[model samples]
Target: MIVIIDNYDSFTFNIVQTLAAAPPGAPADWQQPDIRVFRNNKITVQEIADMAPDRLLISPGPCTPKEAGISVEAIQYFSGKIPILGVCLGHQSIGEAFGGKVIRAGRVMHGKTSPMHHDNRGVFFGLDNPFAGMRYHSLVVEEATLPDCFEATAHTDQAGWL
Candidate 1:
């Protein structure tokens, strides 16, 4: 089962819908897996363990990780236990949990698109480089101070530097 911890983002269900849709190259037998969604502050770590989810997803939301409830705790508890995918605030929480710095971007990028560049590593692997990516954020994981254990998988020319 796949479990998602929602952080009060409006797009959480949209993500779920996207996941439910068949992938472009998916085989004929491909089907959406069982999924469960919970509020960030509603679920406990023990409850998650009992579910035995194959993957955990942290949803985007307003404010900082400190205010995102149990997201960081969930990430820390399930670091190696299972694969975890963090989006927006969740991603920032990952950085914070791993000793990286999360801070306000030089410019807020609401309803904007940027030419995201990547070396095709990590999440960008198996995809085209320098793709147009939609962005809506005012905070980011500072690349300069990112922990050695992690690397900036992607960036853009129109960055937070304004």
Candidate 2:
């Protein structure tokens, strides 16, 4: 099962819905796994422990980690227990949880598109090197603030990371 922790972002519901949907004419191997969505305010580590999900996906939100009221307890509880995929704000949360910093972008990047330069590693595996992606963020993670274990695998001309 895949557990998605929703951050109450405007895009959260849509993203979850899309992930839950099955593609038309999908192959037999394209199995739709069981998925669960929980709002950040209501979700707890105990619930996550009970679910025993194969992976956890942290959805993006409109504010910083501090503003979102994401507790360090939750981060600590989930870290290293399961595979995690953090989107936008959630990505920032992961960085902040590991003693990294978040900063206001030089320019707001709402509804913008950019060519992403990727090393084609990890999550970038099998993806095109210079793929186009939409940007809708006002803040960014400080590359220098990231732990040595992490690397900036992808970047864009406008946004340093995506």
Candidate 3:
């Protein structure tokens, strides 16, 4: 099952709606696209894993990565054992979780549809061209911190890859 993890320190209507709108389809191809909110600053990754999600998708939240006190070590613990998708902090967590570094980008990228570069296998599967996607983050992955197992499937001047 694809579990869309609510990374928020708290739960909100948007997070609920995102999950309600898109529930997992099947065990083999299940994916939770909804934005579940942790709603509480005390929430932990182990608590998230308890939900029995086959894969994990980190969603945006009120807490910043640094303020949230998220440990890459915790995320690393859940690495290849399960499929993980990091959105804003989610993406950053994935990088940091797996020995990659994350830093604030020189500039901010906001809005829909931006130019991106793909290495080999893009983030969004089946799309061949530069993809149009949502953006709402201030940090970017450090090139030096990127892992060999990961590839830059999509990119923008502000943030690269999903």
Candidate 4:
């Protein structure tokens, strides 16, 4: 099962839809994991522990990590123990949890698409180089502030690696 910690972001439903959509021509043996979403404001660590998910996904939100009411310590506790994927605000939370910094971009981007350059590794695996991706963010991660353990896998000319 996969547990999604939602922060009431506008893109929450879209994220879930994208994940739930099965790829065309997937092997018959392929199986989608059972997914459950918990609101950040209402969920507790005990509830998460009870779910025993194979992975955790942090959903994007309008607020910063601090304002989102997610506990950084909790995220750190689950970091290496279970696979975690963060999107947008959630991604920022992961960085901040690891001593990274977040900042406002000079130009806010919304519903724009850009060519993404990637190392073709990890999450970028199987994706084409310079893949076209949508962008909808005002704040970004400072690459220089990333921890030594984390390396950028994708970036665009408009936004460095945020």
Candidate 5:
């Protein structure tokens, strides 16, 4: 099972919907995975582990990582044990949990679409280098403050990575 920890974000359901099906270019044999969603504060890391999830996904939220319930803790517990995926606030939580500093973005983007440059690896393997993606964030993970273990894969013209 794939577990999603929602951080009280409005887009949490939207993300779940997107994950429900294989995208257009995906392999034809791809099957819909069993996904379970829970509020960040409503569940504990130990309980999540009991589910034996194949993936741990943290949803974006409207506050800092310290304010998001269990988001950082989940990252701490599942780092080496399972693959963890974090979105906007979720991404910041990963950085915060790993000793990186999270702060206000130089340019806050809300409900806007922006171009992103990626290494064409991981989720971007078959996509173009500069792809347009939705932007909705006021905070960012400081690249300079990131630990040695965390390397950025995607970047935008405005901020280093989001």
Candidate 6:
């Protein structure tokens, strides 16, 4: 089962819809990908983990939860044991969770497709080399802060790191 952990209500719906609409044999076509959407908002990390199904997909949100009164630590602790796919916010959080740093970009960029530096191997399957993908984020990651487990799969001068 593949689980998508996020506070956004639409996160699961979007994933479910995309999988249903994917071409035959697409990665998301989950013959029965048990997709579980978790809302850790206003809840404890233990409670969130208890509800987790399997693979985790962390979605993007505010630059930092402090403004929203949310701590990434709790969620990170729970996701530590599970396979996780960090999206925009998810990516930043993953880095932050592992002693990485995140900061707001001087400018805001939102669109489909941006070049990325693939320092890690086999991160973007099917791609000949490192390239761009959809991006809708205002915060960027600090390379030095990222843990060794993560590779700068994609990046752009404007976005700093991805």
Query: What's the true lDDT of residue 72 in model 5?
Result: 93
Regions more than 4 Å wrong, model 2: 18-30, 69-72, 119-127
* Model 6 per-residue lDDT tens digits across residues 55-103: 6666655546433223365546755576666676777667777777777
Quantify all predictions' global Cα lDDT against the true fold.
0.79, 0.74, 0.57, 0.77, 0.83, 0.59
TM-score of each: 0.84, 0.81, 0.65, 0.85, 0.90, 0.68
For each of the candidates, give the backbone clash count. 0, 0, 12, 0, 0, 7
Candidate maximizing lDDT:
5
Name the regions of candidate 5 deviating beyond 4 angstroms.
Answer: 24-30, 125-128
lDDT of 1 by residue, 43-133 (tens): 8988998999988888899879999888899899999888787888888888888877898888898999888788764345545677888
Model 1 Cα RMSD, 1 decimal: 3.2
Model 2: lDDT equals 0.74
lDDT of 1 at 82: 80
lDDT of 6 at 59: 60
RMSD of each: 3.2, 3.3, 4.6, 2.5, 2.0, 4.0
Q: Name model 3 segments beyond 4 Å from true.
A: 9-28, 31-37, 40-42, 69-74, 116-123, 126-128, 157-159
After the best TM-score superposition of candidate 4, give how far the Cα of residue 53 lies from its true spot, in angstroms: 1.4
Instruction: Give the alpha carbon lDDT tens digit for every residue of 35-134 in model 3.
Output: 3444324557677678665555566665455544443444676777876666677667777666677777767765655765455331343444565556
**What is the Cα-based lDDT of residue 25 in candidate 5?**
70
Off by over 4 Å in 1: 26-30, 118-129, 160-162
lDDT of 3 at 57: 58
TM-score between candidate 1 and the true structure: 0.84
lDDT by residue (tens digit), candidate 4, 29-141 = 22464778888878886678787777778888888888766545547868888877788888888889998888897788898899999986544555679899988889877
